[model samples]
Target: MRLEIRMSDLTVPEARDKRNSLASRTDVLDKVGVLATLPGDMHTTTEMVASFYGVDVELVRYHVKANREELDTDGYRVLTRSVFESEFGSLSNLDPRARTIALFPRRAVLRVGMLLRDSSVARRVRDYLLDSEQRIQSMNVEPLTGLEYALRLVDAEKRVLEAQARAEMGEKFKRAIEGGDGLTLREFHKKYFSAITETAFMEHLYSKGYLINQIGKGAVRTEGPKAGTRRDGTQHRHPTYKGKRFFYLHGGGIHGGKRREGTRVRPGHWELELRDQLAAEGLAANENTAGLFVIEGGNSKGLA
Candidate 1:
């Protein structure tokens, strides 16, 4: 009773419909592997879905345009106003002014995997689906034992709870970084380099010649009315040229009669460098690393 499935040949209407019907079997996605997504929800942005399929976001948009009706029916949606804010507001990295954000649920992502013709990941997913369908057709309708049924339910419940926990932590980290130009040294250490205390991190910087206590030659003030001038003896520490690559002195405005001068770490470069450093020291697992999760491709343009 196994039917030949050409799920990847999206041009065939019968094939498209066949795959769309199978989209509900999102358990196959679990077999594919856990893709990085925003914590609480099972949705991913177009860019991330593209990354999962190993294709450019532009290619994803192209497929969306060609199959909008089918995709929309499969729970593809463009969120806006309060809905957008409610769903994605926690992602401080997203532009505050973004009026619309498109989200593809697990079903829609599975649909895309079926529709995509050029991606190797998509091809593999389609092959998996076809083989799975054939196997199901070939199997007898045996009733599951009570123990096996309970195990399945437990596994499903565990996945849901784990996803919820990850989502909460992801939102917390994003909130911690909001309203700031970049991460402070303390914040950076807390998030990415927690093995050592802030004091120890400062000492590491000093020992590595990245920071110095005394105002050396070419030292420039980076904050207050004296900013851009030679750094005075008043400042506590300054970053050397090498340190400046990852950390920068920021803020020069006077608030409450105090000249504010703070150091901030560059995000991407800092994370990469810190990860490498920790790995070299055999402490990579201790680093609180959040890999890229839900990156939306810029603006809704053709997607809307």
Candidate 2:
């Protein structure tokens, strides 16, 4: 006997509901906000939706274009510059006005999936969706064990402790930046380490260095540096509404974007040539601080 393969309404709305169930069960929906049932917007984009079903982006777009009115409810969006900045503000050295990007939210992707009749990907999407429904039906949520409850308690406590640690560390770092004489980091690095570049001087310090402090992929509310001159000789400025990235080690915010060459020196070499240079400039560091700062004109100072 042959079996007839039919499933319930495997539409985008159904698929989304299915995924939301999966997200709650698995709890990894932090990156994309699909499970978030507020008003309209969800982060499962057109490109992402296409990729999820293994279909060509163009094919998805074609289907959406042919069925615009039907899919107009809770569909696509042209992401504005401000929205894009809010999302990817931590990206380093990017021009905010470079270009506009398109996004397809939950309903839009689902509508396209519903309309796609020919692609194998669309068929797979249907199959998985049905499977997901089945999985949801068959799921057995047993009661949490004593150990599991304890583990959750422990995890919550750990998060609070980590937040406190972060706050304390931020204060220490602020003091370090504003600590010593009014010498800027650029002046300190140039005056001390005479390497081909300031970076090689720093990597040496990371090993023999002080308790190295590093900051990565975060926004600075300060002014972005001047980019270039326009054809009309007018200058363009990065908006204060946007944020720029910075990397820091020790007290200097000048570590990343500097490349190193072959055969960097070891600790023994740091005090000999590097420290000798510092002595001439009336500067000195304990063995902990070796050569950890770079010479870019930042407000941070007090490098050893």
Candidate 3:
């Protein structure tokens, strides 16, 4: 007897339930290739769907073709020869004419299972599919309990704090580089030591017993807090030497140590000018040694 069926006779949910119930069974689902398609939108052939339902492929195809409106609503497409070859190229053992109307997606398989209500396997699959969907949904929403969520939140907060600290350190490094070894002289109110004048700063270093003129490159602190100006015109304390309280003075002055061109003999009396100022600051005669100094190669007497 031909299995007479009418898809319209079943309710929408009823038809879905019928299809899904069979889809959930691993045994029948595996036979149909639908079991292997978990977590992915997979496809199955009419032959496979028929095998899962324990029905003839022709009978399954006949009902699907007759009720195309309802069953082919989604993911159903008839592939052309080129499409079949390109997409299912690796699939072997297909019929000679299979490429004429090629692949069937998962929807087609589910639709077929719905239509073949007479098969006992189809009924079981429908039940299994419904159960599986519920189980999957139950597993989807956060698997964590209250304590687990709280612990995860705390870890996330710690990570955010660590990121903030790193960002602060990076900003400080940029500022230090901008400031002249943190001894960058600035023009503040001239009222009372409002800002350390270049001369006063150098004198202070000399007073602390450091040679003011022979200071070298290693005197500047690159990693610590360098002199930085804020957007509001406020300035922070300049970087200081790690051990001593001496100021790191940048090299270069207007007193005439600079050579214009061609003249090797001191063109300007800048060194004398510096020496005179250090003397005024009560510096010992031979003590201008903290800043950059030139070692006279010809004679030790030429050393300044």
Candidate 4:
């Protein structure tokens, strides 16, 4: 059975509202300030910043760009510079007491002073911010304080891991195809998708068009006729070797049908077929598929 999934779309107004709310928050400003202190030439990008801040990249970029624009504005230039100097200076001096005092605006100097009198609480706050910045950097993404930025980093990391896993699976599948091994969908799942359900796993490959239909059920055929049509269908008949039946490809929704009299199931035939297919497709049989596998590699012809 096939199902169509729809993802909700966000409108410009909704996006703007979220951005405004994120920017007004003090925590966001602090994070942005810290990120600004880091070397600009570093490998960090908008995606990395989003991941570090746990915000969506789009949202993080919006706020960061807005913040940068604000900093460039004549009205905000002096205040922004002052904030940066104060934060960095306090951090460099290793004076948590002075840091707390410098954090507040001029109007709140008295209140800040009163809080500083309690040395322990002031130190805790300073330490918390510093520690937070460190944690953000370790993620290999630029740190931002905005809630949106934080959310982006979380999503980016998730995307990265997912991409890595898919790439690995695709490479394994490619090997199986080239090697002419007779691996069942179940066996493939045990090797790769053991953590996921069979139904979901099959659906994922089907949706990606990595596996195509053979006979009636889905099989490991690549680049063939569309469903309900057969004019351009590609079919493979397994060859017997070492008393085993081995097909060019395997590991789809379908397993081999019962053979005629005296024909026995071939063991490990499907795996060999997969390896051979990978070689034929110009992909290194031993290439690391981690996080880079995609159907067609963004080309018009799928799964290269």
TM-score of each: 0.46, 0.29, 0.33, 0.17
Q: Candidate 4 lDDT, tens digit per residue, 123-170?
A: 343344445545765877555779988899899999999999999976
Name the runs in model 3 displaced over 4 angstroms: 1-41, 129-304
Leading candidate by lDDT: 1
Candidate 2 positional error at 92, Å: 11
Q: Point out the worst 10-residue segment of candidate 4 by lDDT.
A: 2-11
Model 1: per-residue lDDT, tens digit, 44-136? 778778878888988999988988998898889988757866754445445577677778989889888888888877777777887877798
Report every candidate's CA lDDT.
Answer: 0.67, 0.44, 0.46, 0.36
Higher-ranked by TM-score: 1 or 3? 1
Taking all chains together, the TM-score of candidate 1 against the true structure is: 0.46
Best by TM-score: 1
Q: What are the C-alpha RMSDs, in order, of all predicted structures? A: 12.7, 15.8, 31.9, 25.5
Q: Count the backbone clashes (under 3 Å) in each candidate.
A: 2, 2, 18, 49
Q: Residue 154, candidate 4: how far off, in angstroms? A: 40
Candidate 4 lDDT score relative to the true structure: 0.36
Top-down TM-score ranking: 1, 3, 2, 4
Question: How do the residues 45-145 of candidate 2 rate in per-residue lDDT, one tens digit apiece?
Answer: 44555666566768777766765655565546656657765764433333445465455655555445445666565555555555666887899988899
**How displaced is residue 122 in candidate 3, in Å?**
0.8
